[model samples]
Target: MAHWFHRNPIKATNAVTFDFGGQASTPLARNICSEARSARSNLLTIFADPTRDLTVLTDAAEKYLSILRGFVEPTVDPNSQRPPAQAPNSEGGEVESMEVSSSATGDSKLRNAIKFTWSNTLAEKHSSQHDFVFEQINILFNIALWHTKHAAALAGAKEDIAEDDAKEVHKCLRSAAGIFNYIDDKLTVKLFERTGDGTDLDPNIIKAYAQQCTAEAQEVTVARAIELKHASNLVSSLAFETGKQFKIADNSLKAVEENLVQKWRKYLQLKATFYLSYAHCYNGQTLLAQDKCGEAVRALKESKTQFEKADDLGRSYTSTKGAGKSAKPHEHAFFRRLLPLVRRNLEKVERENGFIYYQKVPEVVPELPSKATYGLASPVEFVMPSKHEDWTAETYNGFKISKPDAEKREKEKDDAPKPVKEVPVNQTDKESSNSSGCTIS
Candidate 1:
């Protein structure tokens, strides 16, 4: 035996001591409890994650199938069994013949007999397995319905159900049909097992199920058609509005218009492609829906291209050296008149491109000379000098000497006699007297 210590005031001044077995059990229980709590928390965390939720859904589907299988068939107990009740005879004696005649003559009597026989057979065949199958069908149908509704809510089409939702509805109907098919097959199997022939048993149940499937499929088709029509109308309206807003005035605005047209065209082309693809999927031929979509796209693209070209022309016109600048004073007036057209076109582009159309236009300065350099006079005159003659200082000041005064001064200087030089008076007299005497002798 193991001894356990007890705390006593007399022994060690301790207040008390617990039994070893109980104390050991307490620690073990706490450890187990702590582990269990941690496991539960971890499980809860995993369940909260979305990925885990999808996995759970899948698992649930599989489990539902298992439950369905269980309902479809069950093991029969060998003991405590009783014989089935005897059914009324169809041909029982003259009293019997009379009785049979009475039974067969009335519709209500005949119907009741058939119903009772059929009910008895069904009860005999009923199994947990069949119930399980029904449960599985129900579960799948509900799950599909839930997914459909969830998707519809997400799409903001509370009133308008999507194709996928419609498909789910079909699936549910098909599941119901499947239940009937299963029962029919089971009935056939039982008939064959009992009489080695199943051709004689009525196929009303399977036929009815198939007919229901057909009806559901038709409904889905109708729903899809309606949805497609609505979508087409919406897209058409948008495309029309886009086309209406583009304008073609002024070079800058024209460029914007062209770009917008191109964008709109591309958008139309994309939309048409989508519609054509949808048409192909739906196998729709009514109204030549696919062809119309293609045509619309092409037409829009061509229109956009033409608009772009027009814009290019406008840009070229405005971009010319003297575009905004006028040689005449009235040119500004012309531009002012055209300003409205430019504004309208710009607005059109803005509508088409959304935020992209609002981009800044490049700054363009007019080429006209500044007013300070070129006077405001019309028919500007340029007075050029007669020739490349050098201008004298006086000529530059606008003061000129008269030609007659210049000529008079020149003649006076030329005609005036030179003064005679007087030699020394004595030398000059002697030379002159000697020359005179020589000439006289």
Candidate 2:
């Protein structure tokens, strides 16, 4: 279970005390900056291990992000925008006052001179910037990653997980999805520029992470439906949707570095194939329940094909090189648990088709059941927190910024590369002895 998730590490950084010029009249700015930095440090350094408490890490993330908001525009007041960085994501979206340089925001007068240095998770190297927005984006990425880690912890618990724990798993994943969505929908457009694949702020990486979380959350929904013994159609519908979700996530990373992302892509591929098997297996059950022996026999055969494909991926997912721990999903009981069920169902249907129904098995597999009508996962709504009360415009405007290199800005604008976009795949199904998610590995 430790290897269940291929988590991206947080941006590491050296410390900086927010020491400003001696002209300041108040300690208010210093205190807020110090606490914000401390919270950030604490958040980044948390071990990526799943054994840690979820609530502790979650609170620390919010505390840091809310305080850091003070140093930026529109968050601190109706007006505090900063000067433009190298360039915007021009791939398209909302660009705030970030593009418009105006002294009225006190943006030109008080550049927050404290240089924030942070490492890129994939690049495994540090890049320093005077940008508060840089800190914001990185901090948001870490918190979202933490939620995925917590979901793993809950699912990987040594004891059988309780129903409430399943709910927590669902909640944690959706929370991760929401933060990632916020990054794509709101924050990335505000980025002075795309940090490229070397950095987590790259749009394609964000989309992949967002889709994975949303898909993983639905895996929980599938497990819950089975535990509750929901209808055959509902279970098959959900399982089909889960497979589709995993495909989208895998597709999002199509052009990401193979050395960096191949293992994760393999995990998505295996899961997609696994859940397609589930969808087929259950759709077969739905058909059997409705006495459509011909379709049931056909669907079961399709499930067998997908199941074999997932079994093949299990090995590759283990061998593939990439960041984070490699999962032993092939060996995990959760993965093998479906085989007996599929076999039993397929055997039953084939026997019935021959003796009772006398229906002919068709060559074509039935189309995948329609998308689930309900109980699918959606991102929890996320809005940037209001700036901490202590960070009034007066306190924020006191500090000046370290200006970005104008030359480098122009160069990056000319040199920025197009983003990588890929297609994806995925797993999970029923008659389980217990209720838990597939991502638990």
Candidate 3:
């Protein structure tokens, strides 16, 4: 039964719910790996045959979404009002099933007679909180990608997908966006928590995941524009958010590129460029839809330039020793595939609306200054030591200091003063004092 459920979750969930009558006593638990596998399989099936029935593919995606949501952000079950179950050792308690094997008895002694069943908590501890969410994001992205492609193909065939299951497609895209939004909101909370308390975890992981969510959300928004044949309100607003997300992602990728050296830096930079080009490409489409031909041209041009840069860097990264062997052929295939569309659209827009007000301007990014100049340890001042009237000081190869001797002065006062003739006294003898002592200051 577990194998069947793992293989087919949608039907299994339905069966379990029906058998238990929506109660929690049956303990219908979900396996994250199994769910992820099922989702990936569904996506691969769609990719295998793009012309497959959209209805079946969409149903599979929705089911996978439900399963994934349970993993990362499970909602309170409405039927969870029943009392909790006691432990297996208590009255009316249920023992969790476990497998036990027995070996042949040898010389009146039994081997492997006892077996212990490990609880679910042991497994749960091994999986980090972010792991499940990351997996879900990957699945959701593929689902959204499938929806976008299918919906756009339908739009192309029928001028608009509004009449033919448009609502379903819209729902899928919106769910994808919702998943992304949920991730972003929770990630913000996690970051705040880590900020207040010292945490050893690297925040770059969350930042990278946030970038994926934003990029996938942007893809959904762009697909919606394409399907609806308009981009005035919804698309325009989404473009603003998407652009901000792209900027954040760019900063994160810059940090990553800085940490790497030589070929790796170029490789990461190329990946960053590929991600940015998608944003630019979609933003260009949005601008063109709004009839801002000049801005649209600029965005599209930027997209094309980024594509060229990515290609060159990618080639450079691959030409290095050992990098080519591990290179992924589909690494930036999406960007490459989209570049021609951007170029074609740019030409179409220019031909329809002449490039009268378009002009390029050069911009420079100055290096950021060091923090030491105005930082906490800045504004230093020098101080000089002051000499006291009672002390004598000298510096040569070493410093010698002399201070008045109170005891010697008192003794001189106590003793009878000897009158000295004012005959010739050497300058050094006049400067010497028996009433003073010297110390390093």
Candidate 4:
């Protein structure tokens, strides 16, 4: 009887309910109760088990239906009038009838009644939160399929596993892929859009996702490695693009170029030496990597030297260019006159240092006298004395001689004889002097 009740609890419970209606039967009610409890216990055990075999689900579903059946009972009361038990229709008869009903009205009423009862029963037996619970169940179902595939693989029946199990695993993998794809799309869009706007998105997130994608690829077959590689390349490209954008936004190109030239120049020289040494050490001339390294080092060093020279020359040129528009004309003229002098001095220094000096000599102009006595002086001359003299006493004393010598000079001037006039020329003058001389005695 227990086996029978477990096999068909609904029929058993209905039989007991009908027997109680016709004749009072406490034994039948007790038997029905016992069967329902046993079935519920077995169902709970089956669900609690970790193994999710299809057989277990079928058993649990059967048990759940049995538990529902055991809850149905016939009410009994001798003093009160009660309605007759409605016969179970193929589609259960309506618990209530609607007045003034057309054929559509009658159908609608029956449908609403059935829907309400069925939904209420399902809710009461299950839960209001069943949607969330069912979703979790579905996820578990996928996980179960995944485990089954893994088990088959481990059991050496890899080929024999149902195609559905593989499909299930693929489905899960696809979900993970979708997540990655979404992130990739989002990052790409943001990267392109914000690139011009000059924003730096986090790089760590991209790196992490890339690692995840790579890790996920391990589960895939070798045939999919190429796909994985493509994905990885995309990630790498995005990272590179992001870094480049950041570098440009930061204006680090010039600084980086300068730094690289500075750093690599030394290594470049060593690189050539290193390659030659490597070749000799290994006794092989075909190893070109070392040579390339050396060449790179030398190239970088040369580049650095050139850059430094250019920078210095630029600074010097700018400094000597002078400043301001107003100062330019004067600066030009000054340089025009002084450039020859500067070049001459520079050449002299270079010559002293045993270097060849190649400066042009300036034309020499001879000094001219102030007086017109020299051909160099201008013909138009004023009576003004030479500007060489000043009125200072020192100038006057420069010409001073002895006073006696000065008088002697004067007497000599007096002692010099005057020239005598002819008598005929003074005859009238002599007669006039004799006529005027008589009154003077």
Highest TM-score scorer: 2
Which candidate leads in lDDT? 2
TM-score: model 3 vs. ground truth: 0.33
- Quantify all predictions' global Cα lDDT against the true fold: 0.26, 0.70, 0.36, 0.25
Clashes of 3: 4
Q: Can you tell me which runs of candidate 1 are displaced by over 4 Å?
A: 1-158, 186-188, 191-202, 230-441
Ten residues in a row with the worst lDDT in model 4?
1-10
Q: What does candidate 2 score on TM?
A: 0.82
Cα lDDT for residue 419, candidate 2:
18
lDDT of 2 by residue, 1-441 (tens): 112445555445556665554423357656776777677667666634444678777677667777777666532445635432332234564323332453454342233345566666566545655567776776787678767877776776543568888888899899989999997887667555566574577677888899999989999889888888898889899989988998999988887777767777888898889899989999999999889999999998889889999999988877777765545566666678788889999999999998999998889888877778989999897778776777775565444333345665545322221211111101222333543233432
Give the root-mean-square deviation of each candidate in angstroms: 55.9, 8.5, 34.7, 58.8
How well does each candidate superpose onto the true structure, as a TM-score?
0.21, 0.82, 0.33, 0.18
Ordered list by lDDT, greatest first = 2, 3, 1, 4
Worst 10 residues of 3 by lDDT: 1-10
Candidate 4 regions with alpha-carbon error over 4 angstroms: 1-25, 69-161, 164-441
- The per-residue C-alpha lDDT of model 4 at residue 287 equals 16
